[model samples]
Target chain A: MRYLLTIVADGMPEPEKLAVLQRECPRWVHEMDGRGVRLLGRELDPPEATTTVRVRHGETLVTDGPFAETKEFMAGLDIIECANLDDAIEVAASHPVSWYTAIEVRPFAGDLHLGEAAAAFARGDACGEPFLLVTWMGGTPATPVHDQAVADEGDGWRRDLDRRGLHVLGDALGRPDTATTVRVRDGSTLLADGPFVQGEDFIASIDVVRCQDRQEAVELAASHPVARHHAIEVRPFCNE
Target chain B: MTVKPDVRQAVDAAFRNEWGRVVATLIHRTGDWDLAEECAQEAFAEALRRWPSDGVPHRPGAWLTTVARNRAIDRLRRSERGLQLHEQIGREAMLDDITGGSTPVARAREIEDDRLRLLFTCCHPALSLECRVALTLRSVAGLSTAEIARAFLVPEATMAKRLTRSKAKITAAGIPFRVPPAHVLPERIDGVLAVLYLTFNEGYSATSGAELIRTRLCDEAIRLARALHELMADEPEVTGALALMLLHHSRRHARVGPDGELVTLEEQDRDRWDCAEIEEGQGLVEEALHESRVGPYQLQAAIAACHAGAAAIHDTDWAEIAGLYALLEDQCPSPVVRLNRAVAVAMGGDIDAGLAMVEALTSDPRLERYYLLEATRADLLRRSGALGRAQAAYARAIPLAPTDVERRFLERRLAEVRATGADESGPRPS
Candidate 1:
């Protein structure tokens, strides 16, 4: 199983704590990577530096600030492949931030390789790959004929992307209710079963694909087989 | 002036009926929600422009779908980007899929399935509860952003952002658009039903605001539930949910006094209840009960039916109502449900037992902020002839009441309790 380790703190840590994070984060990443567990890791810019983009009724709307506003600020994130949730918990606990702040380990809804698209980012090879997060929104129970069409038509689009190496990773997620949320608090590793975000229109499946730009991303998103009867969104990872 | 009034009316009606279908179909073919919505909106706009001159098409849904598909294709072809997306059209979806190309029965079945899929997607649990409500109203029910925003008391921009945020999350999270498979269908259907019920409740009693009722939201919820019942006729909970809404909505008129004071069910004028709605709701409750697959809504509807059937408050079967509530408590199990069951138990007979039940509930931290707990205790105390205790309970409840109308009602009860220091019956009926 793959889990996303989200490092968060109540606010900016003291400078000495920052120096400790800067000192420990790389060592932690190197160790995880040495173990072939870390697929990707990045220290994000602050929330103020974040930019939120949304396409509504075909119009691209851009706004300043993070995708969501909350008190606890996300400082960094890492994607790690683990044997099971217990192993993932051990890995999170090893991180220095877990002792002082908070580290949330959430599994991806599906298979993904964030490193696959590192070259295609808008900022070019200077930064990581800019992959469009193709989320397959909700769909109704498929009619017999519709399912056949998807098997016949949908796989073709995905395969073509794969053949060109544009498609990185994709798969359906476990049910949201099956989701397990983990947190390290007061020297205790607390575990709860639920997604981090409490939102409507949950994720059904996801695709990570390299796209030329937002227009191409939208176009590509529009072409998924399930996109016919369902909702789909094409967004870039923030670092992109 | 070229637009005939009838043509305009026809287009408006078709937009209401066919907008969801057209949009869903276009999105399926083109693989773009924006394109689908834009094309569907344009199709209606086109109909308003062309219907008078072209004569009203025999099949307005088919006509609208064809126009939307054509627009989607045109827009795709014209857009500078998307060589692959434009190539996506090469697969060539059957245009008649939206129109139900085969037999009439097949067409109706397919269209309904599409609507159901949209509903499930709109009500997916991944989205926040608010987003689920907003999306269902907007995407599935075809309410505009402005209208939905107004109904929810959010700014139009905020509603627009919410819709965009929801759609983005759907794609970002990969929420499938289909109805959940058999294994998860029970829970997913329950989720959909919850959204509609919550919507109805929000309108029936504005939880936070001063307004006692917001019928528009209640109407929207019923409209959606009615449609859901049609789509999933075999789902007893859907039928029960619809029945419950109808039964509760039936009392809208009598629920408030002439001066807009909130009236307790016992104090409401029974003659003012909408008889036609009660009859329809009662019929639905009967039909759902016949399924023998009782859920929370079925139990609730049964309790409401018990009340609706009675000619006078005193004539009502409180014991039966209490029994139904017990079933409901077993079904969902909430402090609020327990509170309601206590009221019914008191009405049935044993005041002391009911008071004990109510008294024990006070310790629950969850009910600490729930004003109804205090109010219920006050009512039971008053009934048991503990006027001073009842007065204190009522005064405590008045401050905790969420709305002014409810607060004023509590005040009235408090005054009545205070005035009647000594009564042989030992309590004043509110």
Candidate 2:
């Protein structure tokens, strides 16, 4: 359920290595944490400062260097608790070093005794709120349906949700170009921009609701008017 | 040095994801499934050594397969048995008869032929209908046995055995991986079209996924259908399958909400529908209908065309759809088809007739546990003012519904009936 992703950034010596870890790793870690995956990351001292000793025939053989003689050394590690290996792998694979240095993913071997810290990391438990995010292109409202038309046509949906004691959150009318664009340049600082790369249209709004998982959230969102025209992106919120 | 963990993970993901496509291309080029798979594996192994340092190539599959093929050739030169086969193949290569290219499109075409070959081989007359479907889904559609089992609501182990037996039959009967002769093309093409249609349907309305629609799967199925259409332009069913896929896909944008929730057809915004795809699909339907010889696919396409042509839910020609469903039943009489036909009949104002048809289908063993069937019957009953029966039907349907969304929807229907306190509904649920 939990994996420690150890990214070994070997060859690149000096401040460049530390800079990459400092700037890139935190952003990636924050994104994962935002998605409800508990993350704890730290940078380790260089391998040269580390010591490894082997005992054979009651004799100790001490080595001044690291265990593996690879260009990249174990620079840092991020501990992530996920629902399953697949989920963990998705997170690990998205790390900055996934495309460059070697990332070692090892499952947590045993249960942890975190004491009071565990409660602080527990995810939120809000669920069963029905909401529809209707996205409109060019900042336009959905087709003018008389209150009667919606009450008539969407009666089935309303009746269904009402029986379940679920109430739809009020709709958001998004700006013409509401998306915030971020670009990772030269594997460093992210460049922020306005409105997703100009296309035929832009994402108008996002419907947010409290649900159990992606599947439930998606199904509930599908009934919204905006989904009929624009793309829908689903992301679960961290309970905390 | 031990392989870097990140490199290992990337290689593994790439292997799992790209292995099939690479093997498919190699199998077509080499004309040997086992050898192509081996070559593809070898190529990936080489990538593990080089990619971390040099960075991944722009076209990884092409690079991997080329390296593997060259490695295979070098190995062949070193072996006595391989040398003889290599010489024969070399002669064919010298003759300039074999197609050679490294582009993805060219490789895809080769793989497409292999797909056609696999389709025919899987649907060989010796195989049972279930076996054919399982084999086609596994080999051609690239679905795992577990995925196929989930689709058919069967145990994974049983499905795996079924796949094994189907493969064994192919081997024993010497079913060559090639298209059947022209004389038998019509019937064989039907099997191929059915398999493709099923694949597309599964993708368009995934039985279980966080997303309502799996666009990748839909795209893949459409691409396959298009290839079949191109190969057999004279075949009416091929045209029909392509038309149906286009028409259905044209509604994909309107099928989900901005928050990724499911959307029922009646609530969909008509202006959002892709008009270009609709136009293209309409053209194909017209051509297919002109053939005079009606098939199940063409009939289904006709039905979809009716829905697509409508300006709004009220404007839908329910009578025409009901008529098309009647033809479809005559061509392929299944409980599911009849159930859908009942809805059309109800929409056409023949509520009594629709209710009767639905009631008849409830007794069908094939539909006893089918949630949609119960839901359909409940809708009819509720419309006819039979609240007690409708409530019971909805309750029965709740347990059978697979997804939370469907269950929630059904529960809502049940509540409405209860709230009305046995009053007959004004209009039937669509």
- lDDT for each of the candidates? 0.73, 0.62
Query: Scoring only the second chain, what is candidate 2's TM-score?
Result: 0.73
Docking quality band of candidate 2, CAPRI definitions: incorrect
Candidate 2 displacement at residue B47 in angstroms: 9.6
Q: For candidate 2, lDDT tens digit of each residue in A14-112?
A: 677657765876688789878868544445555564333333333334445543344655565456666543345456556766645546444432332
| Model 2 lDDT per residue over B202-275, tens place | 67775356232255457656876786787678888899999999999999889776655557777799898999
Q: What is the DockQ of each candidate?
A: 0.04, 0.01
Instruction: Give the TM-score of each candidate.
Output: 0.66, 0.51
Candidate 1 error regions (>4 Å): A1-240, B2-9, B51-56, B81-86, B90-104, B207-213, B422-430
Deviation of model 1 at B299, angstroms: 0.7
| Residue-level lDDT tens digits of model 1 in B340-418 | 8998999888888889889999999999988999999999999988888998999889989988889989999998887
